[model samples]
Target: MAKRKIRGTEEAWETGELGRDEKYVEVADINESTIDEALELQMISIRLQKSLIEDFKLIAKINGIGYQTLMRQILKRFADSETKRLLRECVRAEEQEAKEQRQMEEIEESRKRA
Candidate 1:
């Protein structure tokens, strides 16, 4: 793709615009990628009353983020944190205790089938 110089009209620097500079810029081809992950079960059901929906939109607009994108990022971050915490706890569990006992029992049961 070819690159071209673009002048910034005053409207480009409007309030709540993200990463806006006062000077004109030369824009190149935009490179963006979408995440591809297996679909998981939906976990949340949200009910937004009229006033609450309005307030949520207001907050999102002020922060210069799309409401849906903001929510997706927030949930992804929280889930990542929770998964890390659970993994850490699992790694710290006692090998000579309940975990070892459970593993031994499973092996014994498998041997009986053979």
Candidate 2:
């Protein structure tokens, strides 16, 4: 029989499974005593609007994530980081389009004059 190598410690086994082609996470099995010690310090509650709840559900479906998990990922991803970049690209493309349009108009005007 072939021996299988275990990761971390004997308390856990790790394997890979496709999560609706979205992403991967590591799940671990730890001693209940350890968990109890970790949970002693905090309690937090957050509220969300109904419409935003529905939109989050839709995004979670697209990303193959549970609603809560999707929310955590979004918060951690710092969603606004790309806004300035995308806006700059959009403005540059619009300017280039306008310049090309003016050039074409000038060419038509020259043809009319000829």
Candidate 3:
């Protein structure tokens, strides 16, 4: 097989001779978990409205990305913002509880002194 530079714009690619110089190797010990870990990706499935999916596809095309990638980005952003908001609410509640406890302690101390 002759090794030639592969060009996408060439007419010869349509003749199905593009990969003639390519080499193929088989791996006997492939681990899916290792591949997923290396890529930091997890597979998940969820059902969505067909209209929602069509909207995403249009928006993704306008943004020059696949709809799935756009969905992932939106999910990530929502999760991050929601996590932060929940954490802040939790902290505020804890602070308010602590303040009320201190106020009760002050009232008890005043009663004891009287």
Best by lDDT: 3
lDDT of each: 0.70, 0.76, 0.90
Residue range 1-114, candidate 2, lDDT tens digits: 997754554345323322322345566778777885796533358888999989999999998889877886786566565776788899999999999999999999999999
C-alpha RMSD (angstroms) for model 1: 11.4
| Range of the 10 consecutive residues with the lowest summed lDDT in candidate 3 | 19-28
lDDT of 3 at 99: 100
Between prediction 1 and prediction 2, the one with superior lDDT is: 2
lDDT at position 91, candidate 2: 100
The TM-scores, one per candidate, come to 0.39, 0.35, 0.68
Worst 10-residue lDDT window, candidate 2: 13-22
TM-score of candidate 2 relative to the true fold: 0.35
Q: Model 3: how far is 3 from its true place, Å?
A: 26
Model 2 residue runs over 4 Å out of place are: 1-43, 79-114
Report the C-alpha lDDT of model 3 over 14-64, residue by residue, as the tens digit.
676564444653555969988888889899989999999999999999999
Model 1, 11-107: lDDT tens digits are: 5546525345546457656433222223443446787688866766787899998876667777789999999999888777855478789999999
